[model samples]
Target chain A: MSRALDRTGIWIGWAFFADLANALALTFGYMFSRPVTMQYPDKEKWLPYSRYRGHHFLKRDDEGEIKCVACELCARICPCYCIEVIPYEDEKGNRHPAKFEIDMARCLFCGLCEDACPADAIALGQQYEFSSFSSRDLVIGRDDLLGKPGKAATGGGVVSARLNTEQDVLVETSEPQGYNWWRNIRRT
Target chain B: MELVVALGLIVFKVALLIAILLLLPLPLTWLERKVAGHMQQRMGPMRVGWHGLLQPVADGIKLLTKEDHIPAEADRFLFKLAPILALAPPFVVFVAVPFGESVSVLGTEITLYVSNMNVALLFVFAVIGIEVYGVIFGGWAANSKYAVLGSLRTCAQMISYEIPMGFAVIGVVMLAQSMSLLEIVRAQADVWNIVYQPVGFFVFFVAGLAESQRIPFDLAEAEGDLGAGFHTEYSGIRFAFFMVSEYAIMLLTSVLAVILFFGGWNGVLVPLPPLLWFVLKVAFFVYVFIWFRFTFPRYRYDQLMAIGWKVLLPLSMANIIITGVAFL
Candidate 1:
């Protein structure tokens, strides 16, 4: 009975007061502290890393020619079988893709296709904002892939061509530097 | 002519109070989500309007448009009546709550509350008691084992907690020497009741939380175990009504706490109006309620019962004795 009384006294007197004090202190501390939320869209769009895999794109040379030589390697390496490339000989007898399509719905944003490309002609761009209404709208074509402005575009083109020796050309152009494209997309 | 005028004034006050009660929950729901989000390092519900201010409006429209379903084997009448039963009591209780001291308008003194009865405290308690019936009916009528169990637990919890709650209020009533809510507020003019009756305040706060079925006492709607508990079968506007009533009850409890302990409308040399001070105090308590919801984990069913019966009951009883002896 004495032990029970002791327990009750401790609980009613010490435990209750201590818990209330702790709760009040923690609440006041949090109330004055800065919220960790970034408040996306209203404040500023949060950007992921530059190497973040997003949309697929076909690259262009310094002369603005399609760099894809219809290698069929990207389509072969694609796990989702989303990429379709048909190579045809140009008037200059140079190999170029006549029909290149990437079904964004099927594309897993995996960088395997980007890694397997011998010519560095295809890449997963940093532009993740590709939400579309229709499934057909998500299927990106060769023209749309090439339509991105050369200077602003990053990832989906020949940033580094292994076979072409356009390393000097790649250096001359301002390489898409930081992970700032996400913020840019939000404003527009 | 005088009787007609008095009736018209009463109708106007009731209408105004009802409008405020109905509209208050929208912003409060938004605030709850915002507080919860900020505390957890996320911006919650920021698409509809500036920082998702219009989220509750959109939610209301969505609920209204959605299909309302009833279980096939459920008791139809009770199921339909349960939401109204749940939603009405909190508003009824609000009529007794004095928002501010009497103020002169158009050369006549008018009280800010809808109505102030001599036994306002008893009226508030009586109306609040009716609220649990709604939950019980909702759970029972659903004809599900989980729903029945949820309702049973709620019934047990509310009843047990109400004892300590009543005893705590009795301590306040003893100090004030009156049951009227306004009288209780006036009694605290010199110093707030919290300074004198700290234990009573603690018991009252905990019991009030249990009565409202908030976190740490939300076994009635323990979603993990009971799948939305009593309201599992309810959907659409009916569900919205349940949610709105819960928030209203929360608001009412905070207001009552302010009146009982913190000296309602009493402030230290503030330039603001008394009504504003009252509102600010109530808002602080409301924010604290949301903070507590996020801070504490739900109590176990058995532990909740033990706290109510063992700790709060005896503590409140002792507090009443202490207050009586001290006053003597």
Candidate 2:
């Protein structure tokens, strides 16, 4: 009678307990599976997609002369009313801004200003760091935005230079980095 | 002089046990984070010390230095007492826990546990139950909606699962014919209680998970929706106290499982010391709990209740009946 009872108990456990056991086994297998988190800044900075909109910077020609004509097309088209421009014309007929400023605190980052600019002169740069402790500091001028792509700046910084290709050179969120990139991080 | 020496030994044992229990959470937190990190194939807490071994020390210092804030609307008295209530009971439960058989030192015999009451299991259950009051008081005192809801869930969850947990223990009690934890371990000399009471162990495991407010049953820690649940108002040392209670409770559950089922300190095959075997077994279960935390998603509130009341309670009742009849 006791043997029969024991058999029934085993059958009950076998039928009912298999699913929980199966789940545990499956997850235990994944204990050795690859972690997808790419440690940013300390490791690989996620380079934004080409044509990715970030902080703005003024363009320069070959002689390092500022390319902005002070036509104020970007300032006019800005949706957030964050841009301020004071046009200046040099004695030699060179056109530039006397005091050009964009309050990044208020700016929408819509990339519309990039589209409005003539020949992409006041185009948005690949720099991502725009935060400042004070609102006064956030109102960036033309000089502050020139040739600076923040600290993660390596070729074109966090933003890609060229448009994205079929085989993505820039690591997009869609792909998991299954390489030995983490090994390069020197143990502190 | 003899009486004084005996009194001194008791005091020494109590102090040592308290110190060990208090310090245990540091290693446990480190182990938990490492387990979680590795289970997901990442290194957790590697910055502070070697493999994040000193991470808990860094965290303790950080928590200690933080600003202590109490909301203006909160009940000041209950808010102060809540974390204490939560933390103290788990330690109190330790007084009755049978670590192993006695050891002789300097010609004086010293038992491992502080006290081994004949009804130690009952004492453990009864005292540990008081831990919920801490949750309730903390939630009610916070004067926040999330805190209250979190506390209510913890209360209902504990009350519901406590029944099945009781039944699970009853099966072991019936099999061993004793309520003492040490006696229960002694009963499982030749064969572990797991072989005879598999269903009891299953029920106990499920209910213990709920009791500790762990994953799948940790609907109370509704970080997703309830914004840290009952601890939304807590910060710094106050929060640390609650965390200490949580780790202690997890340890307590692991210890119980070892004593009740796995033949406490009974070595198998390898001739390792009994204390080492016992510690290894407890460590294994602790890892299993951490494994479960990462492995399973939190059950919905309704699902948690359903499992507690509809599933485990009935299952444990059946287990009790079967164990009784089989033994007879």
Winning model by TM-score: 1
- Residues forming the 10-long window of minimal summed lDDT in candidate 1 chain A: A158-167
Stretches of model 1 off by over 4 angstroms after superposition? A1-24, A31-43, A148-188
The digit string of per-residue lDDT tens for model 1 on B20-128 reads: 9899999999999888876654567887888899999999999989999999999999999999999999989998999887899899777887777889999999999
Under the 3 Å rule for N, CA and C atoms, how many clashes does model 1 have? 1
- Please give, for residues A47-131, the per-residue lDDT of candidate 1 as tens digits: 3455666666777899989999999988998999999999899999999999999999988888888899888888766555667
Estimate candidate 1's RMSD in Å.
7.2
- Give the per-residue lDDT of model 2 (tens digit) for B1-328: 9999878888898898889988998999998888788667676887677768999999899999998788899999999999999999999998899888989989878888878789999999999999999999999999999999999999999889888998898988997899999899999988998998888998898899999989978888878878687877999999999999999999999999999989999888898888899999999998889889988889998898888888898899999888878888
Top model by DockQ, which number?
2
Worst 10 residues of 2 chain B by lDDT: B38-47
TM-score between predicted and true chain B, model 2:
0.98
By DockQ thresholds, what CAPRI class is model 1? acceptable
lDDT of 2 at B62: 94
